[model samples]
Structures are given as structure tokens and as C-alpha cells.
Target chain A: MDAIRTEALTKHFTVGFWRPRPYLALEALTLQIGHGEVFGFLGPNGAGKTTTLKLLMQLIYPTSGHAEILGRPVGDVEVKRRIGYLPENPYFYDYLTAEELLEYFSALFGHSAAERRRRASALLDEVGIGAERRLQLRKFSKGMLQRVGIAQALINDPEVVFFDEPMSGLDPLGRRHIRELILRLRDRGCTVFFSSHVLSDAEALCSRVAILANGRLVSQGALSEILAVTIRGWELVVSGLTETALAHAQSSAGIRGATRLGPERYALELPMTVPPEHLLAKLVAAGATLVSLNPLHDTLEDFFVRQVAAAPEERGLESTRG
Target chain B: MRAIGHIAVNVFRESVRDKVLYSIVAFAVMLIAVSYLLAQLTAGQDLKIIKDLGLASIATFGLLMAIFIGIGLVWKEVERRSIYGLLTKPIRRWEFILGKYVGLVLTLLVNVAVMTAAFYAVLAYQGWGVDELARRAWPAPPMDPALLSAIALILVELMLVTGIALFFSTFSGPFLSAVLTLGLWVIGHFNTDLRNFENVVESRAAAWLARGLYYALPNFDTFDIKAQVVQGQHVAASYIALSVLYGMVYPALVLTGAVAIFSRRDFK
Candidate 1:
């Protein structure tokens, strides 16, 4: 069974005022997240990423439809007991020491006194807060605070962990540590759902991704399948072409697109089907020498822009498929 | 229940660390000392005046702690975004509110205890006329019987105020909640006078409206037996029992409403 599933899940928030209209934040978002997979959700700002997380966590009520976690309805206490959430820009009680904060959360999760101390100690160490567990949160830097936030989320040994923009505001080293932690969580057979706007991280870490735009699920599936349909091609450059040769080369159209790259050099885009030699020989026959040939592949970002910009019906097909 | 206890413990610790508690304690002590000096000015009312002032300070300071700190408790959680972490746990919203209320009450209990001890120390020191020479220098202590009754009344009063503060916190911001709670306190203090005025009204409809308002507001004066205790009148245990019951029931009603509103609120 999927660790997470949503069918026709929708949420509308009413702006409380004299004259009001409900704003739809998530429109019929449906997807299934399998256990032990790192599912990446990529979207620009206000694409309903945070709203989806909020609804899943039951911080706010959904207008219609339903979402389930671990076979239980969303917001069920049993489901909540197995899930951990790290909110974007998490804030903590400034007066609490790292150890104290973890202990507090552990108790809330029904950990015994002995288990609370043991787990808190281990988590503090795992998050690299071993040496400064006694220091108050106010004294810690932003990166340290983030580490503590992660520790607090993991205190329950949750089966599912949701991280909303976990890498925001972190230094390069901090970002790498978070990525490693995410990998470690996934390795432990925990279902990890994290949201990010940066496509590189999603491409590198996620086996599958869901892209959202304007509060709608645009595309979602295995990263490979999403890219397979979007074409991949290479770039070719040629130089020393006369006006008649340029006209001939342009008219022949062996390459997909030919545009001037330099004073006498022009760049040609060729589909992967068209071999580099055929394009080079064509340029040579047309009285132009091949200057540069480089292959370019489609990235997750390129696919994101294309998928998010596509028509609604076509976009929904990618997300709704099993 | 365990989660509530955990949150309560943390809130108690945080509140104790605030400088305001110590300042209130020090101020109460100073008030008790000043009462002794002021009592010296009145030849025969030393003990009576000291007891009145001491008990009054305890009640006032305790109320201040409850209203000011309770307003900030939930507001602080929202402002710092800690509510997100708490909500994600396996705890209910009512538990959070209950825990915060318990923690603030605990803080008030400690602060009031300190002031009570200081007041007792002052009374003990002044009760025994020092030496003949000291007694000659200082005026004789006054005989007061209502001090105990006043202290009991103050406890009941603080309970009611804590409830008011928590109820206001459910739907209002810190500043507005504080103001509303203070307004309730002021109205409650003169609740008996309002009832008496309501009784004297000539028009039946106007009297009914006045009576309705009086009953809707907390009848705080019913808890006070200070005059009877001070006058050396025999105050019945039933009076204290009834006052404590009144204090308990009103706050429970108010807290129920607070929890109802809080449970439905969307913490976006």
C-alpha cells in the first residue's frame, strides 16, 4: 500500500472580510507516494506547496476531498503519531536548551522518561548538536537552529517525514548535511516527502517528482519518464560560411535550428536522431567548416517549465497515472 | 494528559525565569514593610492596616501576573511558530490551552506564596511588641481579625482572574486580551455595587436589564469576608465554602468557552 495517497484533494481558503471569495489553493491534487521513497515536490512560490503540507498535517481544514497517510485518514491521531514534519522557517522557544527542547517533544510523543533522555541524546548527537546541547536556542546560529528543528521532528522515530524547503537559508555545508540526512532517512525505509524550488537537488535525490504551478499539480512521475518524452538534442557550430552557403545551409534544414553564435560562426541545434557527422558533412558540403559540437540534455528544470506551462488536461495526465 | 503535563512544565520553567516575578515579589515585600511604617502613623491601627495592605498586595500582584503572562502564553506560541511543532504532535488543541493555563497558575501560586510568606514574616515581627524601649519608640500594634478571611478571598479572586485571562486569549491578540481582562477585573471589583444599584431601580424593565448585566459579570465581592474578619466577627466556614465554589464554577464556565473557540481556530 502507498504510504501517502490523495484523491481529488482540494482546499479553499476564504479571505475573511466584508466581501469575500474563496481562494483555491489545491485543486484536485491526486498522487500516491510509496514508502521509502524520497518524493520531491517542486514549485515556484505560491504554487500550493506549503498549503498541501499544511492540509496533510491538519494545521488547517481542507474544503473537500480527502488525503490519507499510512492507510489512515489525514489528521488521524494514529497517522499523526507516525509522521514528522519540519516546517519552513521553523521557530523554537528561544529559552530552551537543545536537550530540553527534544525532551519536551519526546514527552509529547509519549516517550517514557528513560526513553526520552536516551532518544534525545542520540538525536542531538546525530544532528551534530552533541557539544552544545546545553546551549539555549537563542544563542545558536540559523544553521544550528535548523539542525535542532530536524532533531525535534525525528524525536518520535516517525515512519514518514515531510520537510518543507529544508535547504532554505543554509550555507553550502549545511545544505550538504541536510541532503545527507534526507538520504539517511530514506535509507531507513521512511517515506520522505520534501518540497523545493531548486530542480538540481530534486533531480539528484528524487526517483520521482511532482511539479506544481498556480496551485495545480502539473506533472508527477518517475524523473526518467518525465524527461523521456521531452526531447534531448546536441548543439553544433560551423564557421567560414558565405551568404550563399548560409542560405543553402538554412534552406536545407538538416539541423533543427541554426543561429549566428559569432561573427562568422553559426550554432546549429540537431535532434539526438541526427548524427554529428551528417550535420558536419552537410555544413562542409555547404562550404562551411564545423567549429564546435556539443551535446545538450534536458534537465528537470526544463521539463518543469514545459510541464507547468502545458494545458491543464495534458498536465493532469502526468500526475494522475498510476 | 502527558503532553499537557510536558507543556505545562516547560511553561512553568519559562515563566519563573522572567524578571517580572522577582520584581513583583520585591514590590510586595516593600508594600508590606511600608504598611508597617504607615501603621506607625495611626496609633491603634498598626496590625489592622498591615494585614489589609499585605493581603491586598498579594491579590493585586497575583492578578497582575496572571493577566499579563497569560495573555502572552498563546500569543508567543503563534508569533514564534512553535505552535506548528506542537500541533503536529499527537496532542489536541485543548490540551495545549489547558497546559498553558496550568503553568501560568503554577507561576502565580509560587509568586503569591512568596508574598504570603513575606507578609507573615512582617506580621510575626510586628505582632510581638519588641522591647519596652522599642515599643515606646514605635506605636502599639493594632488588633485585626479579618486578615485570614481577606487572604482566603484573594485566592478565590485570583482563580477567577486567571480564568478571565485565559478566556480572552482564545480569540484576541495579546494587547486586546490584556485590556479586556483588565476591564473584566475592574467591573468584577464593583460587582456588588452594581447589583445594589440594580435592586434600587424603579422601572421593572430597566431593573431587569441591570440585574441581567450584574449576573452576567463575575460577582467578585461575594468572595470577600475581610470586613467581618477584621471586625473580629465570627465568620462561618460556610461563607468560605460558598465563595470557593463560586470562584471555581465561574472560571470553569469561562474556560469551557475558551477551549471551544480555541479548538475550532485554524492555526494557519
Candidate 2:
């Protein structure tokens, strides 16, 4: 069975007292995440990524359709036992120390006291919060609180984990640490589903990714497949050249542009159709030494930007299959 | 059951950590002490005055704690966004509500116990008098153990009030919940007056409305045995039984309503 599945799940929020107009927060969000895979739900702010996570957690009800986790309905208590969730910008009881909070969460899953203690200690250390376990949560910094939040989420040793904006508001080191932890969960065969606007993290970690724009899924597929924008061409750098030689390379056939690096250096952009052998021969004959040749590959950020920038009508027309 | 217990313990710990709980308890203790000074001015009726004042202070302060803390119980979790971690667990919504209610009730129990102990101590000190000659001139009355019955009844009343506050909190924000719960408490105490007003009014609609309100609102007066206890009158066991039943039944009904509303909330 899929780790998570949603069929046309929708949510509409009402606003204003006098008029009470309905605002569509999520619209027929259909998705499926396979077991033992790291799935990234990518979206910009207000793109319904958090809303979808909330609906699956049963913190809010969907206006239409349904979601299932571990082959059970989203709100099933038994299903929740196998799932752990860390909400975006998580806030816990400030009065509880890290140890107390984790133990309390473990107890919710009916873990024995000894088991709770063992798990809380291990998870606290795992999340890099072992040293701060005795301090109250109120004294924690934003990053520390986030680490503790992850510890609590894992205290139950859940089979599936969901995180909303897991890397949000973290320093580079903290972000790297969380990325490693997520990778560890995946390696342990725990399905990791997280929503993020940070495309780089998604690219670095996710096996499969889905992008949501304005409450609708615009694109989704394996990272390799989705990031496969055909290489437009290659970039060639040549140095130790005279102005006449630079002008020759710039005017060469199939040369897109020549950017000056210095008085003696120029970068030549050539389309894929151009033969590299021909370019090398021209540069060497002109007494221009080759600095380097590098292939230009499109990044996930590039695809994300293209998908996000497309009009709603265009995205709807080209929605990618799972 | 274990989930409820865990949540209840957490709630109790949270409440205990709140400085407001200590502040209110300390203030009530101070008032009980002040009652002793006020009693001296009354001369012949000093014991009666002290007893009445002490019991009244306990009830008043206990009511404030119940309303203030209880109304914020669930609302605080939502405002702080801590409910996300909780509701997403294997626990049910009704268990969350019950756990919070039970925790606050336990906190109030401790508060009432401390105040009651202080009141009894003051009574004991007063009854003993200062010196041998003072004791001969105006001998202090024996400390009555029956005062505990009054304190017990007050606890029952406070539990009901806490339930009302929790019921309001499930759907409303703290300020509005406090207002509605306090309003209900006031109206509940005057339910008898509402019934009398119904009989006196000639307008049928007004009469029926008053009558409906009387039945709809909790009759908090039923929990008061303070007057009798203060005057050294014996309260019947039958009346205690009925009042206890009423207290238990009303809060249970209110809790059921709260859970029903809370279960439907989106926690948005």
C-alpha cells in the first residue's frame, strides 16, 4: 500500500462576519506517496502545502474528498500510531523540559515508562538536544525548539513521518543537520514526507517531488525525470587571447555570446548543435589557450521557477502524472 | 485511559507552573488572615464573623481561579498552537477535553485544601485565646470539624463552575469565554430569583422566558451550605446527597457538550 494517498481533498475557509465569503485554501488536491520513499511537497508561501499536511493530520477537516495513511483513513487513531508529524513553526508547552515533553509524547503512544525514558534519551541525542534536555522549552532558541520538536515526533518510533517546512528558520548548520536526520529516516526505511519551499533541500534529499501552486498540484515526478531539461549547450572559457581573437570567437557560427572575463580572457557560449571539436580548433588556431569547458545542466530551482511562474490555466493544462 | 492520564498530568503540571495559581492562593491566605483582624473589632461575635469571612474568602477566590484558569485551558493550547502536537497523537478530542478539565479540578482541589487548612488553623488559634486570663474573660468556642463539609460543598460548586468555563473555552477565545462563564455563574446563583420573577410577571411571554432560564441555568445556590454551617446548624445528609448529584450531573453534561463542540472544531 502507498504510505499516503489523497483523492480530491479540498478545504474552503469562510472569512468576514457580514458577508461570510468562502475562500478556497485547497482545491481537489490529489496525491500519492509511495512507502519507503522521501517525498517532498514543494510550494511557495500560501500554496496550500501546510494546509494539505494539516488536513492529513486531521488538525483540520477537508471540505470534500478523502485521504488515507497506511491503508487507513487520515483521522484513524490506529493509523496515527504509525505516523509522526512535526508541524511548521511548531510550538510546544513552554513549561515542559525536553525530556518531559518527549516522555509525555511517548506515553501518548502507550510506551512503557522504561521504554519512554530509553526512547526519549536516544531521540534527544539523535536530534542534538541531549544537552538541553533538562532546560525548560521556554529557554530554548528557535532552532533548539525545532530540534526538540523533531525529537518528540520520533519518540514513538513511527513508521512514517510528516514534516511541514522542516528546514524553515534554521541556520545553515541546523539545516544541514536536519537534512542528515531526514536522510537517516529514509535509510531506515521510514517513509519521509515533508513540505518545503526550499528547492535546494528538496533537490538534495527527495527521491520524488510534487510542486503545489495556489492550492493545486502543478508538477510531480522523480527528481531525475522532473529536472531533465535538455542541456541548451556548453560554456567554454578561453584566456591569453588578443582582442582580434576574442572578436573572432564572438562572431563564430553557433556562438550564443562571448562575455569578457578580463583583458586577455573571454567566455564563449555555444549551442549543443555546435561541434566542440570545431570550437577548440578555432580557439587554438587563434592562439587562445582553453581555460575550461563545462556543461550547463538545469537545476531543480530552474524547473521550480518555470512551473511556479506559469499561469494557472497553463499549469492546469500541463499537470504532470504521478 | 492512559492517554487521558498523561494529558491530565501535563495540564496539572502546566497549571502548577503558572504564577497566577500561586498568586491567587497566596492572596486567599492573606484574606483569611485579615479576617482574624476584622473579627477582633466585632468583639462578642468575633468567631462567627471569622468563620463567615473565611468561608466566603475561600469560595470567592476559588471561583476566580476556576473561571480564569478554566476558561484559558483549551484556548491557551490553541493560541500557542500546542494543540497540533496533541490532537495529532492517537488520543481523541474528548479525552483531551476531559483530561484538561480533570487537571484543573485537581489544581483547584489543592488550592482549596491549602485555604481550608489555613482557615482551620486560624480558628484553632482563636479558640485557644492568647493567655489564661483572656480565656477566662471570653472563652473561645471549639473549632468545628463540620466546616470541612462546607469546604467540600464549595469544591463541588467550583468543579461545576470549572466545567462551565471549560465548556465555554472549547469554542470561544479566552476573553469571551471568561465573560460568558462569569455571566452564567452570576445567573446560576440567582436562579431562584429568576423563578420568582416568572411568577410575579403578568406578561406570559416574559414569565415563560424567566421560567425557561431558571431551568436552563445551573442552580448554584443548591451548593451553598455556608450559612447553615457558619450558624452552627446541622445540614441534612439527604440535601448533601442531592447537591452532590446535581454538581456531578451538571458538569458531566457540560463536558459532553464541550467535547461535542471541540470535536468539530478545525483548530485553524
Candidate 3:
């Protein structure tokens, strides 16, 4: 069975007093995530990523449709026992120390005193917060709080974990630590579902990714398939070329554009259909010393930009591209 | 049951650390102590004045603590977005509501107990140092055991107010909840007056409205035996039992309503 599935789930919110208007936060979001896979939900701000996570967690009720986690319907208490969630920008009780807060959360899951103590100490250390276990949450920084938030989420040792903007408000080192922790969760055979706008992080961690734009799924599939852009061409660099040779190269067939690197040096881009041997021969024949040649590959950031820039009408249709 | 206990204990711990709780408790103790000085100003009724003022101080301060703290008990969690971690847990919504209520009640109980102890200590000191005039005017001891019954009834009244505060807090912000709870408290004390106003009014609509409010509002006067206990009037054991039962029933109904509203809420 899938770890998470949504069937046309929708949510609408009403705003304003003079003339109440309905705003669609999430619309007909149908998705399926398999067990034991690290799935990434990618979207820009206000793209309904947090709203979708909130719906699955039952933090807010949906206006229409349904979702199931671990083969049980959303809002099921039993299902919640097997799932851990860390919300974006989580704020805990400031008066509570890290140890006390974790113990309190573990107690809600019916952990005994000895178990709570053991689990709280272990999880705090796992999140790199062992030194601050006895420090009150109010004294901790944002990164420290985020680490403690992760500890609290894992206190129950849930089978499936959902994180919304897990790496938000963290330094580079903190971000790397969280990324490693997420990878560890996946390695332990836990199905991890997380939402993030950081395309690079998502590219590194997610086996499968789904892109959301304006409350709709624009694309979803394996990272390799979705980011697969066929190589359009190659570039060749040469130096010690005369002005006449440079002009000739610029006007050559299959040469898309030529850029001057410095005095008597030029970089040439050629179509894929063009033979590199022909271009190199032409440069050598013109007495231009060969410099370097390389091929360019499309990155996940390029695909994300293209997906986000697509029109709303084209989004749902573009999901079939991968 | 375990989840409820967990939440309740956490709430109690949070409440104990709040500066508001400490400030109110200290002020209440100071007022109880100041009542001893005020008693000397009254010639023959010094003991009676001290007993009345001391008990009144405990009830008044206890009511303020209950309303202020109870209204924010649930609202603070939502305001700070801490409810996200809690609601996503294995516990149900009703359990969270009940747990917060129980926690605040426990805190109020402790504050009232301390204030009651301080009041009794003052009365004990006064009893030992009574002048010739006070000794002749009042043969009865100043440290009356009956006062404990009055304090107990006041605690019951504070519990009902806490329920009212919690009930409003489930749906409204803290400020509005405090206002509505305080408004209800004022209206509840005048429930008898509302019934009398219904009979005296001529307009059918006005009379019906007053009568409806009288039946709808909680009758807090039943729990108030401060005057009787201070004046050394006999209070039957049956009266105490019935009043305590009445106090317990109102909060139970209010809590049920609160849970019903809270369960339907969307944390968004």
C-alpha cells in the first residue's frame, strides 16, 4: 500500500468582511507516494505546499475530497501514531527545556518514564542538541529550535515522517546536518515526505519529486526523468586566432554564436548535428591553437524555473512531459 | 487518560512559571495582611471586619487569577502556533481541552489554598493578641473552622469561572474571552435581581427577556456564604453539599460546550 495518497483533495478559505470571497488554497490535489521512498514536494511560496501538508496532518479540515496515510483515512488517531510531522517555523513552549519538552511529547504517545528519558536523551543527541538539553527553549536560537523540533518529531519513532520546509531558517552547516538526518531517516526504511523550495537540496535528497505552482501540481516523477533535457550542442574554445580567422569561424555553418575570451581568443558554440572534428579541423587549418571543449547538461534548477514560469493553463498538462 | 494527564501536567508547569500568577498571589497575600490593619480602624466590629475583608480578598484575587489565566490557557497555544505539535499527536481534541482546564483548576486551587492559609494565620495572630475590648465584645474565637467552608465554596466558584473562561477561549481570542467571562460573572451574581426585574416590567418582550436570562445565567449567589460564615450564622451541611454540587454541574456543562466547539475548529 502507498504510504500517502490523496484523492482530489481541495481546500478553500474565506477572507474579508464587507464582501466575503473564497480563496482556493489547494485545488484537487491528487497524489500518491509509495512506502520507503524519499519524496520531495517542491513549490514556491504560497504554492499550497504547506497547505497540503497541513491537510494530511489534519491541522486544518479540507473543504472537499479525501486523503489516506498508511492505508487509513486522514485524521485517524491510529494513523497519527505511525506518522511524525515537523511544521514550518514550529514554535514550542518557551518555558520548557529541551529535555522536558521531549519528555512531554513522548508522554503524549504513552511512553513510560524510563522510555521517555532514554528516548529524549538519544533523540536530542541525534539532533546535535545534547549540550542544550537542559536549556530552556526561549534561550535557543532559530537553528537550535529547528533542531529541537526535529527531535520532538522523531520522539515517537514513527514509520512515516512529513517535514514542511525542514531546512528553513538554518545556516549552511545546520542545513547540511538536517539533510544528513533526512537521509538517515530514509536509510532506516522510513518513508520520508518533505516540502522545500530549495531545489538543490531536493535534487540531492529526493528519489522522486513533485513540483507545485499556484495550488496545482505542475510536474511529478523521478528526478532523472523530470530533469532529462537532451544535450542541444557543444562549445569549443580556441586562441591565437587572427581577426579574419575569428570572422570566418563566426560565419561558419552550425556555429550558433561566438564569444571573445580575450585578445586573439574566441569561444564557439556549435549545434549537436555539427561534427566537432570539422570544427577542430577548421580552427587548426586557420592556425588557431585549440584550447578546450566541453558539453553542458541541464540542471534541476533549470527545469524548476521552466516549470514555475509555465502558465497556469499549461501546468496540469505539463505533468505528463516526464 | 495518559495523554490527558501529560498535557495537564505541562499546562500546570507553564502556569506556575508565569509572572502573572506570582504577581497576583503576592498581591492577594499583601491584601490579606493589610486587612488586619484596617480592622483596627473599626471600634467594636474589628474581628468581623477582618474576617469579611480577608475572605473577600481571597475570592476576589482568586477570581481574577482564574479568569486571566484560564482565558489564555488554550489561546496562547494557538497564538504561538504550538498547537501544531500537539494536535498532530495521537491525542484527541477533547482531551487537549480537558487537560488545559484541569491544569488551570489545579493552579487556582493552589493559589486559593495559599491565600486561605495566609488569611487564617492573620486571624490566629489576632486571636492571641485580642485587647480587653475585643475579648469582651466577642467571646467566640477568631480562628473559626467555619471559615474553611467559605474558602472551599470560593474555590468552587473560581472553578466555574475558569470553565466560563475556557469555554469562550475555545473560539475567541484571549481579550474577548476575558471580557465575556467577566461579563458573565457580573451577570451571574445578579441573577436574583434579573428574576425580580422580570416581574416588575410591563412590556411582554422585556419581561420575557429578563426571565430568559435569569434561567440561562449561572446563579453564583448560591456559592456565596461569606457574610453568613463571617457573622457566625449556622450553615447546614446539606447547604454546603448542594452548593458544591451546583458549582460542579455548571462547569461540566460549560466544558462540554467548549469541547464541542474546539473539536470543530480548524487550526489554520
Candidate 4:
């Protein structure tokens, strides 16, 4: 069953002292997230990713169109019961400890006293906040607070969870832990819909991604499908670069672009037609030692910049010509 | 109903924990104590003075509690964004409003009970004799029909204030709601006077306007049995019953308006 489905869901926010023109934050967005699937919303800043999540969570009303969750209309309490949401830049009560905050939320859900205690403890442990259980949230570090935020989102054992930039403002370890947790949520058969400006995190965590730009969905599919049109190329790193060899390579047709990695070293992007053996021979003849050669894959960062920079209506999943 | 109960219980717990309740109760005790001292300054009408001060403080402090705390009930939920969680629950908006009002009433009831107990305690220690006073001239303490009537009226007055505060909070922020509630309280207190002034107004249009104001605001003075209580007057149970009915109807009207306004709010 589809966990979430939207048909032309649109939301417009009006702002100004007198002349309030509708700023379309979400424009006719239509998509479906399957049960137990990890779907990532990928976009740059101001791409309406967070707005879409807010609409799904019923935190904001759409100006037009509709959405449904678990076969029920969006904003239905039954539908909400099955979903948990973590807002971007969430501001919790500063006076409450992490446990107190969770308990308060649990009460809203009408969780039994026993269930609340058990779940809060388990979630705290899962999010690595069990050690800081006694600490007030106001004194917690940003990373620690984010962990508590995630823990609160998981309190209800929701079948579907929406995370808005959950991995933001985290160190490498914290990022890895969140990525692992997302995987675990998927393993435990929970559908995860998340939004992130960080394409790399989306790439690593999402099974499929939707790319949005200027309040419209530009492209969406499996990572492989999204990047299918990107050009295939090879990377060559030459370590023992003598001036003569560097000069020869700088003037060669086989090396389309060369960037210096360090002193006496250069990383070059080679055309597919040039075999590694021939490149090595050419480098050796030019008085350079070939250190490494490997195939290069386009990262999601490359996809984001190219997609967002294109016209919203003109952009497709296909890669731009190099 | 269960959801309403749940919301009410949590609201009650949170309000009791708030220092506002204790502060109001303490201030009431201090006021009642001051009344005892102030009664000494009045040469011959010590009992009357004490009764006026004690009952008035109860009524005033009860109004403060209702308006101040009741205004924050819904606003706090909105400001904290906790209303999202509640709205997303299987509870109706009316239940939330009713639950909050009920919770605040419970808080006010406890505070009033504590204050009344303290007043009784101080009166007992002061040891005033009621035997010497004329039955109709000066009311007996504890079992005075008028005093009992005043106590009942104070409860009704507090409920009316809570209704007003909740009504304002349905659309306005906490600060504005409190201000409006306080204004309404003042108008309600002088409602009978407004009506009397309307009856004697020279201009027919001015009389109609004042009459409109009199009906529009709560008739708070109708619930002021303090004078009757202090003067040892016999207040019939039927009059008290009728006043209770009036109190019930007015708050119901106010709460109905509150629920309607709150249900339309988007909470975005």
C-alpha cells in the first residue's frame, strides 16, 4: 500500500504589508511513497522540499489539491496516528528535559504509562541519548539535541515517518549514525520520507529520490535512473610529474581537463576512448609516473547543481552535455 | 469523552504545578489577614468590614486566577506548537476548549477552597460574638444565609471570567485575551449600574445604547450577595438557584462562541 499520495497538492504563502502576492511554495506536487520505502526529497535551498513535508504532516494547509496517507485523506487523525514527523530546525520547550518532552508527547498520543516508559527508553537508547537522559535539552549540544529530536519522532512506533533535514548540522559520525538509523527504520518495515539539501546524505540514505526546484518537482526516481544520462569518464592521477611531462599533458587532446592535486602531482579526466595502457605509455614517455587510474561516477551534488540551475520546466532527469 | 478527560487531567496537573496558583492563594491569605487588621480601624462595624474585605478578596482574586491562567491555556498550546499534536489526535476542537476551561475551573475551585478555609480559620481565632448583633442588621458568620449566597456567587463569577478568557483566547493571543477578560470583568461588575443609568438617561438613543451595553456584558453585580451577607439578610435558596441558572447559561453562550471561533482557526 502507498503510505503517502498527493495529487497536484499546492500551497501558496502570501506576505507583504499591503500587496500580498501569493508566493507559491508548493506548486502542483504529485507523488507517491510506497510502504516501507525510504524516499528522499532532494533539493537546494528554497526548493519547497520542507513545504511539501509540512503539507503531508498537515502542519500547513494546501491552497488547492489534496493528499492521502495510508488510503485515508490527509489531516485525518487516523492517518496522523500512523505517521511521525520531525520538523526542520525544531524548537522544543527549553524547560523540559528530553524525557519530560517525550512523556508529554506520549500523553498526547494517549500512550499507556507502561508503553510510554518502555518506548521512551528504547528510543533514547537507539538514538544514543540514554547517557544524557538526565540532562535538560537546553544544555544539550546541537548534535545531541538532534538525536533527541529523532528519538521523539520515533516515540509512537509510527508506520510512516517524515524527517526534515534530520542529518543537518551533524559531524561525520553523527551523520553516519543517522544514516544507519534510517536503514534500521527501513529494516523494521517503516516507510521513511525525508527532505535534505545535502545531496550526498540523500544519496547514501534514500533508495529513491525526488528532485525539486522552485516549488516544482523536476525529477524523481532511483539514484541509478536519475543519473543514467550522466557522462561516463575515467580519472587518472599522475604522481611523478616532471615539468616536461606536465607541459606535454597540458597540451594533449586525450586529457580533457587537468587539475593539480599537489606539487608534482596532477589529477586528469580522460576520455573513454583513451585506454589506461595508452595513457600510461604517454605519461611515461613524457617523463611522468602514472599513480592511479579509476572510473568516475557523478555524485548527487553534481546532479543538484545542474538540475536546479536549469529552467524548472526545461529540466529533466537526463544529464547535461559536457 | 475519554480524550476530553485525558486533556483535562493533564491541564489540571500542569496548572496546579504552576507557581501562579500558589501566588494567588498566598496573596488571598494576605488580603484576608489585612482585612482583619483593617476591621480594627473601623470603629463600630468591625464584623461588616471583615466580611466585605474577605468576600471581596475571594471574588477579586478568583477573577484574577480565572482570567490570567485561563487565557494562557490555549495560547500556551499554540505557542509551543503542541496544538498540532492535539489536533492530530482523535479529539475534537470543542473537547480541547471544554477540557481547558474545566481544568482551569478546577484550579480556581481549589484556590477558593484554600482561601475560604484560611478565612474561616482566622475568623474563629478572632472570636467575634454574633449573639449581640441584630439578626437582620449584622449577619452571623459560617451559617449566614447571605454569606453562603455570596460564596456561591463567587464561584459563578469565576466561571463567567473563565468563559470570557477562554472566548478571547479562541482568537486572540494571551496578552490581548487577558486585557479583554479584565475589561469584561469590570463591565460585568458594573452591569446593574449600567442598566440603572440606561433607565434614567434623558435621550432615548443614549438609553437604548446603555441598555445594549448592559445586556451585552455579563451582569456580574447580580452575583454580589456580599452586602446582603454582611447585613445579616436572609437570602432565599430559590434566588441562589436562579442566579446559578443565569451563571450556567451565560458561560455556555460564551463557550459556544469560543468553540466556534477556535474550530475555524487554521493553527498555521
Superposing all C-alpha atoms, what RMSD in Å does each candidate have to the true structure? 5.8, 4.2, 4.5, 5.4
Cα displacement (Å) at residue B172, model 4: 2.4
* Worst ten in a row by lDDT for model 4 chain A: A313-322
Worst 10 residues of 3 chain B by lDDT: B132-141
Candidate 2, residues A124-177, lDDT tens digits: the string is 888888577999999998988888888888877889999988887788998999
Q: Write the per-residue lDDT of candidate 1 for residues A1-322, one digit (tens) a residue.
A: 8999989888777664786656667889999999999999988876789888888888877788889999998778788789999888888888888998898888888888899999999998887786788988889888788888888889999999998888877888878888888899988998999898988889878989999887788789998788876657778878887667767766665667878777778887877887777657766887788777877668888888887777253222212110
Against the native chain B, each candidate's TM-score is: 0.89, 0.94, 0.95, 0.90
RMSD of 4: 5.4
Question: Predicted candidate 1: what Cα RMSD to the true structure?
Answer: 5.8
Docking class of 3: medium
TM-score of each: 0.86, 0.91, 0.90, 0.84
Taking the tens digit of each residue's C-alpha lDDT, what string does model 4 give over B91-179?
67888899888888888888888888777766665554545443334446544445656887899889988998989987889999998
Residue B212 CA displacement from its true place in model 2, Å: 1.7
Q: What tens-digit string does per-residue lDDT give for candidate 3 at A1-322?
A: 8999999998877766787667777789889999889999998887889889999999888999899999999889999899999988989999999999999999888889999999999999888886778988999999898888888989999999999889988999989999999999999999999999998899999999999887778888988777555466778888988889877866875688888899988888888788788879888998989899876456778888889889374322112110
List candidate 4 stretches off by more than 4 Å. A17-20, A131-144, A168-173, A236-253, A257-268, A272-295, A311-322, B128-138, B142-149, B193-198, B201-215
Model 4, C-alpha of B249: deviation from truth (Å): 3.5
What is the full ranking by TM-score, best candidate first? 2, 3, 1, 4
lDDT of each: 0.81, 0.87, 0.88, 0.79
List runs of model 2 lying over 4 Å from the truth: A235-253, A257-269, A273-295, A313-322, B129-141
